[model samples]
Target: MGSQKFAVLLCADDSDYVKKIYGGYFGVFVRMLEEEGETWDMFRVSNGQFPEDEKVGEYDGFVITGSCNDAHGNDLWICKLLNLLKKLNGMKKKVLGICFGHQILGRALGGKIGRASSGWDIGITNINLQPSKIFSSLKMPASLSIIECHRDEVWELPPKAEVMARSNKTGIEMFRYGDHFMGIQGHPEYTKDILFNLIDRLLHRDLIEESFAEEAKSKLEANEPDKEARKKLCIGFLKGRL
Candidate 1:
């Protein structure tokens, strides 16, 4: 392919499996974008290492992927990433944070994030989008079958943030910062099989119970996409400032 028309940085702060699976998700996103005549490139930020300051502005937007690490921890890389996010937000650059990325965005934007009370580990849950310019082309009750593996949720929105979507399991499932930055707690990038494999691996490692795994699997199987809803959300994001 020719040089990318837009660049997207995928910040990965977890295991190889996260990178592998999320890469697949990015492929889905890229495919959707390409179908609409867009070109993009994806770069990784692993183990805290990332491009220097001089190269930060070369990209059109950046996406921070979910991680196994807790956002409240004192990891050096996490701190650095948070700082970088602040800088990017200050510049009004487009940034989309997913899962752990969502937690970090909340923390960076002066919001509080912590473990959920229900302790819900939603695997493939449906999201209800609120009426906004972001979902104008999408239908009401837009059910997005997304992978939700996060324990922490955004408890409070920052001064300049707006809550976009929510679910019964998680109160603040989606939020937008100022106008350009957005964070989603669920995984819209994961395919059904990929999501199942992830839950399976987690079960194998004893990270979750077998019962939970089975429930998640069933949810994955039952997930139905509102394609028009997703298309509208993506197109709105791409057309807006990053």
Candidate 2:
């Protein structure tokens, strides 16, 4: 943990259970993406916590996590995060955006983002990878399964953005703005237990119908995400080894 410091711009609050078991969303992400000798710092950006301007350059990469809020909204913190993303883009710093992070990166890069007409997409999903040299060295499979839970999506990509993958439910399951910026609409950092807990919470709050929750759980039972492959991709991208 002494080399290659990275930052996580967390966009969601921690559930009590998550805090107790996994430390928090920050801890969950660090477990997924961190490597030996790499330091990871988390800023709870959803609560207006962000690294100071001068501190931005101190990290080698940044990760933006999923959020309950819509990426299309104009909340003050979201606005400020967008500004920071723009600055990061200008600096060519490696940045990985996941879920809401995926949509917000699209918006910040001058794309359209809003509620998906296809409604919510939850559970395991198979995304078809397009032929892209960005991941060529990684030998990624033609298709990969991942945990997905989102009601919003990137409607249009920013200028010069390359769509890397798509699923039956999401047109832009993955996209890249440059060598340094990537956006993924699925939760590769999550395990089935986390999604199960999340589904239960959604059902309890009536965010998702009982039937939908049951179906999502069934799907989770039937399939598993390609975690090792995803970890390789994420870590490679962050470390500039790809």
Candidate 3:
């Protein structure tokens, strides 16, 4: 038991999608966690290739990233992964979910998720965190702009989940599951350059319309570079009573 490390499970569903969408930002996040004297590991659970039930307890914490697939989609791997998340939450392990991870957390807690109205893909946007003990350590802006590129949002929260943040465009932007789990609907790990790359890929793939892509590109470019602050917020939130 002494040799066991304080591990963090990175639940990755789509390799290509994460590479294309998150790209270098993922590395930045991992490095930030490492800098905090934590030993974390990523588990690429794409296409239902997660470990069997016996191996799940190896992790000390968990962080689920966004996926290209919708939470409501009939993906067996998604369901299984969410089930595992529920178990981790029940055990009161530290867990954080971002974007698609947020939606999956909601689903695992008996909440519902679905496509957004007008099928709008929220790019870089500002989110306001509600006053909570989870954010007391850091002085955050009343409204902070962050990277986001999701078409689905959580419509309802699970029984024990508490809404922690909100945005004008998306009602439920952040949530907390009991005490040990937190989820955000935006990518706090993204830097400006990485966001540019993601927008470029989306444009090249025709996943986003030309007009929206151009607008989003301009907005992200104009936004202030604040990755460090957001990363601090992430660390602070996790360090809070959990």
Candidate 4:
């Protein structure tokens, strides 16, 4: 095969702070996921930017990014995205979803998604991975630590989908639909600093309480996300090398 091409469908607007420091969320994701031989492009789906329907097959795989919007919302762009996801599924194209991406993908695949009953999970979380064949070659640990900052989650899996991982707070920390599509409920691309900034923003907007923010900050000070392991899983899956 020729060189692999990948796309990142960004579902969040770049904050002025993120844009100033990280060149935007797209840059952050590319830095984590891109390798020497592969090419990556970004579509700001939150801004209504999307790959043309006829151009969808040009990339080897696609990665969907986290968002502030609810996955269950019927916004025009979200509806269009669901249709695109359905198209991608029909083609068996590789797709990976993170955070909001995960919830939206679940809805697209006929699953149910809504506000998580467990409330907000806004700290480093250890998700228990099933010893499924998908991880046989990954050499992953029984539990993987990652950054979690979401209020919505997948409540039901689509037909034939399998739950790959779970955490105490969320039943579907990870899930897979066949070999081509996967969703992870945490931010593998996030550094602790990014999450910290997000927490502050959430608190400032009254989305989270000061006490909750303090607790999440303390947890961040103690544990680190296994980004390398998560990166391997993502890149390997996207490249069909797993």
Q: Any residue pairs clashing in model 1, and if so which?
A: 93-242, 94-242
Which residue runs of candidate 1 sit more than 4 Å off their true CA positions? 1-8, 11-29, 32-41, 137-143
Candidates 3 and 4, the one with greater TM-score: 4
Candidate 4 lDDT by residue in tens digits, 136-173? 89888899999999999999996699899999999999
lDDT (Cα, tens digit) per residue for candidate 2, span 60-118: 99999999899999999999999999999999999999999999999999999999999
Error of 3 at 181 (Å): 1.3
Question: To one decimal, what is the Cα RMSD in angstroms of model 2 from the true structure?
Answer: 1.3
Error of 3 at 38 (Å): 2.6
**CA displacement after TM-score superposition, residue 204 of candidate 2 (Å):** 1.4
The weakest ten consecutive residues by lDDT in model 3 span 1-10
Alpha-carbon local distance difference test for all models: 0.70, 0.93, 0.71, 0.93
**Candidate 3 C-alpha lDDT tens digits along 1-242:** 33332343344533354466555335645755544445556566544555457766765666777777787876777778877877887778677788888888888888989998847655678888888765665766667777888889999986677898898888898998777778888888766666676677777888888888888887776776456767886675555432
Clashing pairs in 2: 1-37
Global Cα lDDT for candidate 4: 0.93
**Candidate 1, 1-242: lDDT as tens digits:** 43324554555433456447555545655654444455566555545566678777766667677766777776888778888888988888777787877888899998998888878575667777776665654444555656788778888877778888888888888888777788888866655666677787778888888998898788767666454555456556755622
Cα miss at 177, model 3 (Å)?
A: 1.5
Q: Between candidates 1 and 3, name the one with more favorable lDDT.
A: 3
